[model samples]
Target: MGEPSHEATTAPQEDLSSEATTTARGNHAEELTGAAAMFANDRASQHLGITVDDHGPGWAQCSMTITDIMANGHEITHGGYIFLFADTTFAMACNYPGSTTVASGGDIDFLKPTYVGDTLVARGKEIVKQGRSGIYDIEVTRGEEIVAVYRGRSRTLPARKPTTSDAAAPPVPTSP
Candidate 1:
């Protein structure tokens, strides 16, 4: 309808070769315990309005409502939003009760169109976990119908410095 509700945005991948060596090895014993805590700094997920419905060892469920801002040129939900929803669930499933994990690569198939105001739920499950790598499958559904499927490959990052809730500390002072 109106110039494709929300245009998708992507960021360049970060190079952490140096920071990885130091932080990954130092904080092994202190990773966050829950999805909310572990992803408190996930601005991308937060900005997209995705919410965790449930999560536990090797499994996660998340949901998002397709707003006008999330529709594409055809007035249906954008494929990127669906992928983001699935990816978020995959991350939660892979990292529960473990160190940080990131998607190494992923693929998706769109099965049906989703419309504005539709509430889409994404469910993720670990298909396999070996050594430092894992495979996850995610299904995106609306009510009783399937909308998309996503498969992701994940690799656990070496534990990094512990993260704390920003609310737990005083705001850093800024120079006037």
Candidate 2:
């Protein structure tokens, strides 16, 4: 393989704190709508170690570190972890503004299988927003090599209840 394809993003990288803040507070998994629940299926990524930097309507980026737990018997990083990392970024990008959006489908391009200790970063950017649906391009990279690529589709719904900082706008990109 060449490299894993990723969900592309224009997100600026930052020094993420290990102590995760409650990114979503209003509804836990059980309390979420179906769409929200699906989008929220990214708990493992967040629980393990995923950082989401969302800039509403414009960009979203998430970073994940490859650890021993992420490796297979042969020592190559498990592809599931990579997929989750990319998908998690899509969730944050779609859920920015704290709205409920569900992905309809996606196309992913995997470039290569990575190994432990590699810092994989996934970034997502809005491609276009129509009446109630939007498309996003997601990219996953390790340092500089592109590893994975993903395209996500999300369907938005009117808010049932908003999360804390629901209306927050996306921050502009600074640097990785």
Candidate 3:
């Protein structure tokens, strides 16, 4: 009928959903773990008692227990502490072993108050990545209740010139 439609003549289309699935599976486990560990030792995070609980290619989780030092005059955890926890998670999620990522900008919304001895957990996930720019969202929670939310914009730096020491080191295995 009318010389077979062009749409019918085209080859079967590839599944678009598979592209997202494939990207999700691109996580390098070893690199993710190594990066999380390195971030755990950051001076500010360390000083604030932040610990990285998990991370992947575009996701991360970190936690901090509110101590006396983190409390404000009102006896509630300072907003800055909550923001730091979320920021650290965002940083860890955006960075990998060979590439450096920095925050171009970010903002936070404080939803609830956190008190001393409360353990706050911040989970960060990548919203999108196009070319060199990316967006991340972080949720800060105390137990089952959300305390704050943060949005961060990131830019990945160009590949660095490898030094002799770096060039000599073996690539970290993606699998355990």
Candidate 4:
């Protein structure tokens, strides 16, 4: 496994925080739209300490820290966690107001091993979006090095009337 380079002395968290604030200010009109709302209910991602750093109509960036619990038998960060981070970024990029997009398929390639204490950032961009179908590419990186790449295909579901079940379900909790 390749070790993380210590030459890059920049603080990843500070950079992400500033970027997130800038993105939010620039896209204030779309803030209450798709990705924000969907992420509010995304307990899985939240539980894993995944943070949606920035998101716009066709792009998103997310970050996560590899914890000891996420390590595999080989003592590296598990590939599935990387995939999930990429997939979450992809979902944020594709969905918009009035359209609920879902991943039809996805593929990921792991290029390097990550270990505990590493902060991984995944950036997703829309390669093409036509009608109800779209394609997105996500790149996961640790500091300045690329760790993984993901490609995802998405389909937007047609709008439907709310059913009784929808009304009966309880609201998703915002906190524990």
Best candidate, lDDT: 4
By TM-score, is 1 or 2 better?
Answer: 1
In order, candidate lDDTs are 0.72, 0.63, 0.71, 0.76
User: Across residues 78-143, which tens digit of lDDT does each residue of candidate 4 receive?
Assistant: 889999989988988887754678999999999999999999998888999999999999999999
Error of 4 at 8 (Å): 28
Superior by TM-score: candidate 3 or candidate 4: 4
Q: Where does model 1 exceed 4 Å of error?
A: 1-31, 161-176
lDDT for each residue of candidate 3 in 39-83, tens digit (9 for 90 to 100): 523567767767766666677777788999888999998888887
Off by over 4 Å in 4: 1-31, 164-176
Q: What is the lDDT of residue 130 in candidate 2?
A: 85
Model 2 Cα shift for residue 16 (angstroms):
16
Residues 8-52 of candidate 1: C-alpha lDDT, one tens digit per residue: 112112232334223333333232343533544456886777876
**Judged by lDDT against the true structure, how good is candidate 2?**
0.63
Q: Candidates' TM-scores?
A: 0.72, 0.65, 0.71, 0.75
Query: Residue 68 of model 3: what lDDT?
Result: 96
Worst 10 residues of 3 by lDDT: 1-10
Clashing pairs in 4: none
TM-score of 2: 0.65
Please tell me which model should have the higher lDDT, number 2 or number 4.
4
Model 3 ranges with Cα > 4 A deviation: 1-34, 37-41, 162-176
